[model samples]
Target chain A: MVEAEAELKRLMLAGLAGDAAAHRTLLAAVARHLRNYYRARMRGAPEDAEDLVQETLIAIHTRRDSYDASYPVTAWIYAIARYRMIDHFRRHKRRGGDHIPLDDAPELFTAAEDQASDARRDVMRLLDTLPAKQREAIQLVKLDGMSVKDAAARLNLSESDVKVSAHRGLKALMKLMADAGP
Target chain B: MKTDDLIDALARDPAPPPAPPAPRRMAFALGAGLLLGVVLLVTFFGMRPDIGAAQMPVMMKAMFSALAASVAVPVLLQLAKPGRPLGWRIAAVGGFVLLSAGIVGVALIGGDPTERFQLWMAGAFPWCVAIIPLLAAPTALLLTRLLRDLAPTDLRASGAALGAVSGGIGAMVYAMYCPVDSVAWVVTWYSVAIALCAVLGAFAGARLLRW
Candidate 1:
């Protein structure tokens, strides 16, 4: 991990100095890590999490010059990632709908190790049927690792809104899955 | 879609930018930071014209403008950037530019350093530094959304790492540009201010800016 950071910094500096390959390498190396970071925020919504990862990588590339040489490179990346997450919450807020509590979600999906892959996909599809707000809450709290308070705060929403959204998302998921299952 | 496929899709389809001319974005940042800093400096002078008696014209205004740019540039850029979160980099750029400008304007237009020691520092400077940035809350929100959006996948570690780097950079940038003299002052006050700003920018961006 430490070595990776060093490499990232070296590559970052190199990229800033106009090395295209280093820049590309820096972005690719960090891409997966960014995805995981976004994933945790996504709660249960891998799709949304993935979206964040891609966005952050691009941000890093364009804004690389703003980085200060005196600081540790790792922390800077985290700061950007953190800010992006906040943006995610605000956009959903303007749309005005409920979000789900993340905790309620694992319970909903814990049943299938065997069919987990397709089951998860089905769950996501069912989730897609609901209002954008409710779906987002589930994606955040349930799929992502964000604490309810943190997630609620991010969304600029009351905890209840987060909770209700998760509930509704889950209910929608169950209904859709039940209807399709044998 | 598979997670990887999903990510590819997201990466592939960025929102069309408002327009082109990347320089325009940088210019806007410079402008906003300059404007905000100038206003704050002017106000600071007005509120407590009794600070000292003016300082060095060249250095002071330069310093003030620097501060303002440090805060404003990062914000405007963050707002404009497609995926980048607006936090320390944007804040530092805005704050530095604006503050530096204000410092310069004061020295140039206000008067000479008649030793305006701590009067203004004790009065309006605090509020200008503390309260004013809230007007641009949207910048932080944008950053947060960028972070939240990236959190759920392979990018988590890099994100955290990036946050740390940006925080460190914020501190370094403030240190590099601000005219604080003491090492202890640099380590204690300046560094802390940088960290605080960086953290605030990131935290606000993460929560307030979520997409």
Candidate 2:
């Protein structure tokens, strides 16, 4: 574990120096650790765990400059991950209606182990909450991995409209997932 | 999106323009806050008219707050980054406060018993407390905004440090206009004002510093 932390610290320092490849590698390694961290706590809610992993990765990426060199990289990463979890719980508790009582025998629900498909399904589920135009725009441009121009042509909308729709859709999806806590 | 796809997109995105180091950024915030405080001071509370004769007291008062601010800046900078040990920084702050307390204690012991009330109240107590925080607003806001980008883990402590720094700047600026000459009075009332800022910062930090 100490060696792994040293390696992560090395990659993080390199990433801080603008090495995109090292940053990518650091984030991937962090994601694997976050998966286990959240999975153990989230139990049956693998989708929620995956969402948290993604959210934490985004935070680590955006806030990478805040990582100081004098400290262990794992401690910094753990602090950020812990903050996200606290935020997740706070948001869920505030929403009140959909709060999952994870401490109360979360194992009662069959633990879904196939997280890749679970994540795919989760994305689809979140996409379903958007308006039809936005839903289609995101589906074509984001999920299907089509260019904005191609998605615009397919949806019979202008390219800018497709881009705007996809942007708004993603923003809305993020809000939805933030509100939909487990 | 799949987690892998998200990672790919994040990694492919070009790095953001590098931020100035925490110390430099904090210096900028302090400088800007002081400028705003000066503007506010000139507009509302004009400098004391007997400025030439009052120079000694004003210099002493300003030095007191300025030294506090100097100690606080390093601590605040450390707090901006996660996982940085703050033992020495916090100790420095504590030492500054203890030194101030010692000065006040010495003044009380050496001075007349009849003057004790004057030393504590300083006649301008209300103005001191109110104007210091009013002056602090600019620095406090700027420091908090800077801290949001820095991703401080201990939000309340970071906020308190920034607040104390801002309060020091506020008190320093206020010293220029303040006519009071008693060191004990300055220490007592100014410390109260700075403590108020710290409390306010703690509450504000808990709410605003979350990322």
Candidate 3:
């Protein structure tokens, strides 16, 4: 564990000094660790765990300057991860557990279909609350599964702008969802 | 989006342009804020008419305010970054508070009992408390912006520290126009004003400092 901490710290410091390759390596490693951390805590919700892993990684990347050399890199990463997880749970609680399971084998297929459509409806409703650009960016890139290049071309925005809008849109969605809850 | 794809996107984005070290950035921000506060001070209140004759008290006020700022500035910088142990810095802030209290205690004990109330109230009680925070506004706003750029895990604590440091600057500027020489009055009212700034900072920080 200590060796892992040292290696991660070294990579993080190098990454902060404009070493893009080192940053990529560090992020990949951090993502692996976050997956396990969230998976263990969020049993039976692998998709949610993956979503959190992505959210935490984005946070770590955006806020990299906040990292201080005096502390272990894992400690800093986990602190951010913990914050994201708490935020996730808060939003999750507000949404409430509305999922219903149909146990009969004959109904199982239809139930899955129903859930997917219900999820799509919920997403569209939430997306409507975002700014037009953010909503469009997320719809094309995230929901429609378009590449950033394609989405950017369609929207007349730069590729980075598409990514940024999607990121911001997701953050806003989380906030909106949390507020929607009691 | 898949986690791996998201990672790739994040990595592909360019690294932020190089930033000045934390201490340098902090110094620049606070210095600029102080300059604004001083400009406001001179334009409005002007220096105390008797500033030349009130050298002793003015110097004393400057010393106390400077000491407070010295204690707060480092801690504020420390709190702006995450994962650093604040044990010693927190202790140092506690020590400064004790020292301020000690000065007040000595003044109260050594002075005549009949003048105790006068010493506490001194001149410009209302103005001191009100104007210090008013002057601190620029510094507080600047520090908040800086802290947002930097990562602060505990928003409320960071905000309170920001407030305290700005309040110190405000008190320092207020001292130039404050003619009261009583150590008790300076210690008591200045501390109160600084605390008020801190409370306001905590409220603002909690709302504004989220990542």
Residues B63-153 of candidate 1: C-alpha lDDT, one tens digit per residue: 4324433454344334432334545664465455455345444643443355333322322223223322432232233333444433222
Q: Which segments of candidate 2 are over 4 A away from where they belong? A: A41-46, A97-182
Top candidate (lDDT) = 2
Estimate the TM-score of every prediction. Answer: 0.33, 0.77, 0.74
* DockQ versus reference, model 3: 0.23
- Candidate lDDT scores, in order, read 0.49, 0.82, 0.81
Model 1 bad stretches (over 4 Å) = A1-3, A94-182, B1-211
What DockQ number belongs to candidate 2?
Answer: 0.28
The collision pairs in model 2 are: none
User: DockQ ranking from best to worst?
Assistant: 2, 3, 1
Q: Model 2, A1-182: lDDT tens per residue? A: 35689899999988888899998999889988999999998888788788789778877887787888778988888888877787667544423234557684453343333335455655665565466789999899888899998999999999999999999889877865655443
Which digits, one per residue and each the tens of the lDDT, describe model 3 over residues A20-128? 8899999999988999999999999988888778767777887787888877888788778887787567445534334644554555565567657655655565565
On TM-score, the candidate that comes out on top is 2
Fraction of the reference Cα-Cα interface contacts (below 8 Å) that each candidate reproduces: 0.01, 0.56, 0.44
Give one clash count per candidate, in the order shown: 151, 0, 0
